[model samples]
Target: MRVIFAGGGTGGHLYPALAVAEELSSRDPGFEALFVGTSRGIESRVVPASGYGLELISSRGARGKGAAGKAVTGAMLAAGTFQAMGIIRRFKPDLVFGSGGYASVAAVCAGWLMRKTVVLQEQNSVPGLANRTLAPMARRLYLGFEKARGYFRRGAPVVVTGNPLRGAIKPGPDRDARKDFGLSGDGPVLLVFGGSQGAMTLSRAAAGYLLRRTDVQAII
Candidate 1:
């Protein structure tokens, strides 16, 4: 089966789709997958490395933008939809899966307009604007949090699937893991990460907190 996975700007919006695609490929050796995202997103780097094809579209976040910026974003989204439609036509995917992000908006809409089966996966308790807008077009909605169900339209085919995790992730011995990182005598090791596209605010906060604690070892 061929599938088009759309979404990416950060790891939060991208990784789940990758995890699902990876699982599908493993389960079915003949499974084919293509990723749709913006060139600026982390997917540009990660997708190819994961051995999947990626198609880039013109898109950007409309939220927190000024009127002029929002207008420009809208124009980009319209263009992106057209670009996605072209990709969908050429790829002829059996299914189009959308993970919430600005990049998914165009691909999902294009797929729905083309009368293709569309599915969505939302990884946050509060749904994003793209997912909320496209929820009506989806045949199924998979959510990371059960509380997110209330945000979509009533009677929507919502399923609480939690978040898709990569197969490579598994529990390992804490001491061994710490040793691998060259950390010894751990007085509670703190690991701080801001997803694929790092968040400056989160990094700053972590930095401030770590500065006050000498007993804590961190992997940033």
Candidate 2:
């Protein structure tokens, strides 16, 4: 079966889609999956490395912008819709997974318009605009946080499946991980990951706290 995975611009959106794609491939050796994302998104680098065919689409966010910015975003979204429609027609995918980002808006809409099965996965405490807008049309909705249910329309087929993370993101003994990282496991351990690109604000806050408390053993 052919499937299309759409979403990017951030690890929050991209990683979940990757995880799902991985699962799909594992389930069926013949299953084919294609990734749709914007050229500027991290997907340009990450998707190809993951061994998935990546298709580029033009998309921009419409939220938190002035009139001009909104207009530009709208135009981009329109163009992206046409591009996504073309991809959908050519691919003839059995299913389309929307991973929640501005990059996913057009693809998901196109899939729905084409009457293909569309599933949406939301990874945030609060659903983003793209997911919220597509929720009503999605055949199924997977949410990372239960709190997000209230944001969607009632009677939507929402399921709290939590975030779909990569296979490498498994839980293990902290001490072993610390030792592997060349850190002593004898003291308190603080593991801080600031996403793929590194969250500067979170890094600074963690640094400030560590500076104030030298007794804490941190793996940032």
Candidate 3:
């Protein structure tokens, strides 16, 4: 089967699509996958390295921008929709999967316009704007958090898939994990991270926690 996985901007959006692509390849050797993302997104680097065909399209975030900025982004997105349509026509994907992100917006919209079967995966407690916008067009909506389903319209089948995570995230041997962090493995281990670029708020909070608790071992 041929598939197109669309999403990017951060690891939170990209990695889940990668995980799904990896699983599809593992399950079916004949499965082929293509990833569509913006040239500026992390997917530009991550997707090709994972051995999937990567298609770069222009995209921009609409949040926290002025009217002129929004207009520019809107034009970019329209151009990206055409690019995505061309890619879809050439790839002839059997399925199009969208992980919620600004980068996925055009691709998903293109898939819908082409009358292709589009699926969505939302990775946060709150559904992202892209996913909400495309939900009506999606054949199925897969959610990382159960609470997210309430945000969508009530027609599509929603499944709580608990986020398709990479194999590297499995429960590690605490002793080994601690040793990797240069800790003695005698206390609790805290794993702190803010999405892909790292959140300053989370960093500050983690720093404060670490400062107060000398007994804890953390990997940040």
User: Please, what is the TM-score per model?
Assistant: 0.85, 0.88, 0.91
- Give the distance in Å from residue 47's predicted Cα in candidate 2 to where it truly belongs: 0.9
- The worst-scoring run of ten residues by lDDT in candidate 2 lies at 189-198
TM-score, predicted candidate 1 vs. hidden true structure: 0.85
* lDDT of model 1 at position 125: 87
CA lDDT of each prediction against the hidden true structure: 0.93, 0.90, 0.90
lDDT of 1 at 146: 96
- Error in Å for residue 100 of model 2: 1.0
lDDT of 1 at 199: 70
In candidate 3 the C-alpha lDDT for residue 95 amounts to 94
Which parts of model 1 have CA positions greater than 4 angstroms off?
A: 63-66, 182-192, 195-220
Per-residue alpha-carbon lDDT of candidate 3 for residues 101-214, written as tens digits (9 for 90 to 100):
999999999999999999999998888889999899888999999899899877668999898978767897777867777888477878887754338888889999899998
Model 1, span 1-220: residue lDDT tens: 9999999988899999999998999999889999999999999999999999999999998865588888898899999999999999999999999998988999999999999999999998888889999999999999999999999878999999999999999999998998899999558998887653347877888899999999899988
Clash list (residue pairs), candidate 1? none
Indicate whether candidate 1 or candidate 3 has the larger TM-score.
3
